[model samples]
Target chain A: MTVQTPGLIATPKPRHAPALRLRRLQEISLGYLLLAPALIILIVFEILPIFYGVGISMCDWKTGAALGVEGWQRWIAPCVSFIGIDSYTRAFTDPAMWHSLLVTATYSLISVPVQLGLGLLLAYLLFQKVRGQQAFRVLFFMPYITSTVASAAIWAFLYNPDKGLINSILTRFGVPEIRWLSDTTGIFQVLLKPAGVDLPSGLEGPSIAMLALIIYTTWVFVGYDITIFLAGLGNIPAELYDAAKVDGASGWTLFRHITFPLLSPTTFFLLMLTVIGTFKAFNHIWVMTQGGPGDATTTASIYIFKQLFQLNRYGYSAALSFILFFIILILTVFQNRFAGRRVVYD
Target chain B: MNRDKLKSQLTNLGIHAILISGALFMVFPFAWMILGSLQTFHETTLGTFLPEQPMWSNYYDAIVAMNGAKPCVFDPAAPLDILTREKGCMIVRYFFNTMVMGLGTVLGVLTTGTLAGYAFARMNFPGRETLFKLLLATMMIPGELTLIPNYVFMVWFPTPESWIATALNLPNAEPHNWIDTYYALIIPWIATVFSIFLFRQFFRGIPNELFDAALLDGATHSRFLISVVLPLSKPVLITSALLTFLGSWNALMWPMLVTNSPEMRPIQVGLRSLITEAGTQTQLLLAGATVTIIPIIILYLFLQRWFVEGISNVGIRG
Candidate 1:
C-alpha cells in the first residue's frame, strides 16, 4: 500500500458488506405467508361479521328474505321511517326489557358476591397444608369442567317439587316443600313466611325459580373462583407470612394486611370477569329456564336472542346488543379506573 | 400453654370438619350423577344414594339404544314393519357428531393459531404490531354483537337475492343453505382470537437465539420453525389444543342455533332434548351426562399438571 500500488485505495471487508436486503424481504414475506391463514379467517369470520352486524343493525334485516331490495324496502324502510332512536325508545319503554335488566342486575348482585365469598372461604380452607389437598382441589374443580347443559339438567331434576331429592329431604325434616323452578314467589316472601316476618309486597326479591338458577350458577362458578384464589395464594411469598408471624400478626390481622392487599389483583380480575360473564350468561338460561315462568329469568342476553331469532326483529336485537355492549364497556372501564388502581402487582 | 395448644388444635379440627362438609356439598351432585347413572329407573326416581343392586345393564341398554338397535320382537305378523324401524338410541350418533366437530375445531385452532403466533413472535415485519392490536381490540367486542349478522350470512351467502335473480340472464341460484352442514359448525370456530392471542404470548416467550443460530447454519425460516420452535413449544401447544377441544366439546349454543334437525345435533343439545323428553328419567339423563363427561374427565386426569400450569400461565398473561 505504501508503495502506491493503488494510490490509497481501501481494501473491501467481506464481513462489512450489508446483509442482503432481498433475504430480509424473503424472511418477512415468509412470515406473512405463515400468518395469512389465521389472519384471513379472523378478518372474514369475526371482524367482518362485527361490522356487518353494525350495518345490519342500521337496516331492518330479516332472515330468510332478500337483502337490499324487496326485504329492505318492506321491513327496513318502514322501520327507519319510524326509527330515529325509536327502537331504543321502545326498548326503554318496554316493561319486559326493563324487567329483564332488573332481573339480570339483581342476579349479578346476589350471585357474584356469594360466589366470591364462598369461593374464598373454600380456597382459604384448601390452602392450609392439609392431607388430601389435591383430592379436595379436584372435587371442587369437577363441576367447573362439566357441561353446562348436563349440570342444568341435573339441577332441574334436583329442584323438582314432586319427587325431587331436595323436597324429599325437606319432608323428612318436617319442612315445607318448595316450588323450585315453577314458583314465581320471591325468595324473600318464602323466607318471611317461615320467619313470621312480613316483607313488603314490592320487596319480595328474585323468584324462587330464579333463586334456584342463581344457586346453580353460584355452585358451578365457585370452583373457578377457588382455582383463581388458590393461584393467588400460591403466588404470595411464604416469607411475608413468616415475617408477620414473627411480628405477632395472626388470623384476621395477617389476612387483612398481608393477604387481602396481595390478593387484590386476583380479586379485581375475578370481579371484572364475573361481571362480564354474568352479563353475557346465555347457556344456562337457554338450557334450564328458557327465560321462562313469565320471563323472570330472562336476562338481557336471552331477550336479545329472542328478539332476533324468535321475533325476527334483527334491527331491534342489534340495538339491544349494542346497548348491552356499552353497559359492559362502561362498567369494565369504571372498574379498571377505580378497582384497577387498588390492584397491587407484586 | 399445653392446654391452650390443645384447645387451638381442637378448633383447627373443627374448622377442617366444616370445610370437609362444605366440600361434600360441592361434590355431591357429580357423585349423585354417577350413582344415578348406575341405578335402575326405579331407584333413580326414589333418589336413593346407594342402589340395592347396581344395574350395570343400564349402560349396555344405553349403548344399545344409542346405537339405534331395535329390540328383536318375535312377531311374525308384523315382521317387515319391525325390521325396518330404526330404534337405536340417537345419543350415539349425536356423540359421534360432537366428537367430529370438536376435533375439527381443535385442529383448525391449533394449525391456524400456532402459525400466526410463530410469525408474530419471530418475524419483524410492517403492520405486525398494528394487526395484533386490532385483533386484541376485536376481542373486546362481545360475541352477541355479531350473532344476527352471522346468522343472516349463514342463511344468505350462496343464494342470489330476489333482485339479482331477475337481473341476470342466468336462472336464480339454488339456496345452498349452509345451515346444519359441518361448514356452519366448523367455519365460524376456525378463527378464534383468544387462541391466537394465547399462542402468540407463549411463542413470544420463546428465545430468539435458537432460531437465529439455526438460520446462521443456512436453515430456512420454515425449516427452523418446524425443527426448532415446534419442539420447544410442545407444552403450550398441548395446552392450546386441549383448551380448544374442551371449549368445542362443551359448546351448546352455536350448534343448537345452526343445526335444526335432531340428526345434526351434538351430544349437548341431544342431552337437552333427552332432559325435556323424560324430565323424570333421572337415571337415563344421568347416564347420558356420564357419557358426555367421561371423555373430558379422562383428558383432564392425564393432563392435570399441564392444565393447571397452562391455566396459571394464561391467568398471568391474559
Candidate 2:
C-alpha cells in the first residue's frame, strides 16, 4: 500500500465556542501519546537498525573486535572501519553471490509463470458451477496455512531416494528412480546427456533439487493464488458473459476478450508478489535441503543469510542485502510505471 | 439427446477424477505425517505406509527426545543404558518457552497496534496524517538485513537487572547478558507495522458518532479504546492476535540466532535440532514436526472461518 495522507485542517474557532483551543491541544498531545509506543519500537528496532546496517556495510568488518584485555581472554563485539563501497564491489564480484543471484532469477523465471498458469487453471475449474467446490477449495488451501518448514519436511521424507514414496511409485511403474532433492545436476542436462546432446550451461534447466522445491512451493502457494484469482473472477459481471454467448462468442474467445482483460489487475498483483516472494524465499529452501547439494538452490536470501550468520561476514552480507533491496525497488517502480497504468481497477 | 447426455456424464466424471486426484495430492502429506508419527523408526520407510503394530511408543520416544522427562523413569543427565540415549531432548521446555514468547509478543503487538490504530483512526490531531504516512513509508526498508545489527544490539544491551540496579543505586550493578532471555525473543517483534495497519483499517470503519458521544461524556481516547472501541473490535483483535501468535511461534531464524541454549529455544528451532539429531529417523522427525504444528492446525480447524476471513480480507488491501 502506498502512503496516503488526508489533510484535515483544524477548524477555525466559532465566535460562541468558549476555550476550544485547550481541547484541541489536548487532542493533539493525546494522539501523539497514544502513537508513542509503536513509534518508539519501530524507531529503535526498525529505523535505527536500517541506518546502522548501512553504516556497517561501509566498513571493514569480518568478525568480532576484541573489546577487552583481561589476560588471554577477550570479550568480542562487532568490528568495523570505514572502507566505503569495497564490500559492495566484493559482493558484485563474488562468484558465490553471482551464482546465488542467477539461481534466484532462474527460479522466479520458471516458477512464477508455472504457478500463474496452474493457479489460473485451478481458479477457472473451481469457478465453474461444480458440485463440492467449496469443500475442494478448503482442501486445496490447507497446505498454504501450514508451516512451511513442516510441509517441507514432509516433502523431504517423500523425496528420499531409497525408501521415499515417490521413488517407490516410480519403480512400481517401471520408471527409473530420481534423486529428487539430493540430485544437483540440472534436469535438462541430465535428460540431454543420455541422448548424447548437450544443453549449454546457462541455458540448462534448474537442478532437480530446485525443481523439488519448486514443486513444494507450487503445492503450497497455488491455492492462495487461486483464491486471489477467484476473487478477481468474482468481480466480473455475468451479463457480459450472457451477452457474449448470445452474440455467438464461445469458449476461448469469451475468455480472451472479457475475462482476461478484466482479470489484469489481479494477474499483475500476483505477478509482483510471486516475483518478490521467490527472491526472498528462505524457510522452505532452508528446511528441505539447506540450499544443499553444492548450492544448487542457494538463492540470494539464503546466500545473504549465510554471510550474516554462518560466516559472520556482516558488512559483506549487508552489502549483498542492499543489492537485493535495490533490485526489488527497481522492479516495483518499473511495475508501477508500466503495469500499474494497465491494471483495470474498478 | 441420448448421446449428449452420455457426453455430459463422461465430462462430469472426468472433472471429478481430476479434482479428487488433485485434492489427494494436497492432503496425502499430512495424512502421511500423522501415520509416520505413529510408526516406529524402522517402519518409516517406503512401501510401508501403515505400521505393523501401531507403535504408540513413538510419541513417547518423540517426547523424550524433546528433552522432557515425561512418562520417563530418569533424568536426561542420569546414567542410562544405550536405549535411553533418546531421552535427552528439551522439547517440553521448548514448548513452554515458545508459548511464553508467543503470548508475550501478541500482547505487545496488540497493545501497541490497537493504541496506534485507534489514535490514527479516531483522533484528530496535528501531523497525525503525516506521521501515519511516514510510518507506512518505513515499510519500504527491507527487514532481512537488520538481523546482525539487532543481534549486536541484544548482545551489547544492558540487562534489566543492571538498569534496575543502576536506578536504585545498588552496590553491585554489573551488566548481565540478555542474549538467551525471553526479552530478546519477544521484544524485537513486539510491534509490527502490518498489524498496526490492519488495526487502523478496521478502526476506520467505525462511525464517529460513538466517539463524539464518548467525548461528550468526558471520555479520553484511551478510555474509549478500553470501554467502547475494543469491545466492538473483536474480529480485528482476534485476527491480529492469531496472526501475531502464529507468526511468533513459527519463527525460526531469529530465535535460532538469539537463543543457543536448549532451555530457551522455541519449538520450531527445537524441531530443527531434532531433525538434525534424528538424522535418518523419519519417525522422530515427522513426529516432532507434527507436534510443532498441531496447535495451529487445531486452531485453524476450529476457527476456520476466522482464519479464512483474515487471509481473504487482508488480501483486499493488495
Encode model 1's per-residue lDDT on B127-150: one tens digit a residue.
999988878666656566676556
Task: List residue ranges in candidate 1 displaced over 4 A.
Answer: A1-34, A61-85, B1-8, B11-15, B38-47, B60-89, B119-133, B140-142, B156-177, B207-224, B260-263
Model 2 CA deviation exceeding 4 Å by range:
A1-27, A63-80, A235-258, B1-15, B68-89, B120-143, B159-162, B170-174, B206-229
Task: Give the Å error, residue B233, model 2.
Answer: 2.5
Model 1 TM-score is: 0.84
Query: What are the lDDT scores of the predictions, listed in order?
Result: 0.76, 0.79
Per-residue C-alpha lDDT of model 1 across residues A80-191, encoded as one tens digit per residue: 4324465677778888888878888988898889999888888887887777888787777777778998888778877778757788889899989888888888888887
Q: Pick by DockQ: which candidate is best?
A: 2
The 10-residue segment with the lowest total lDDT in model 1 chain A: A1-10
lDDT of 2 at A206: 89
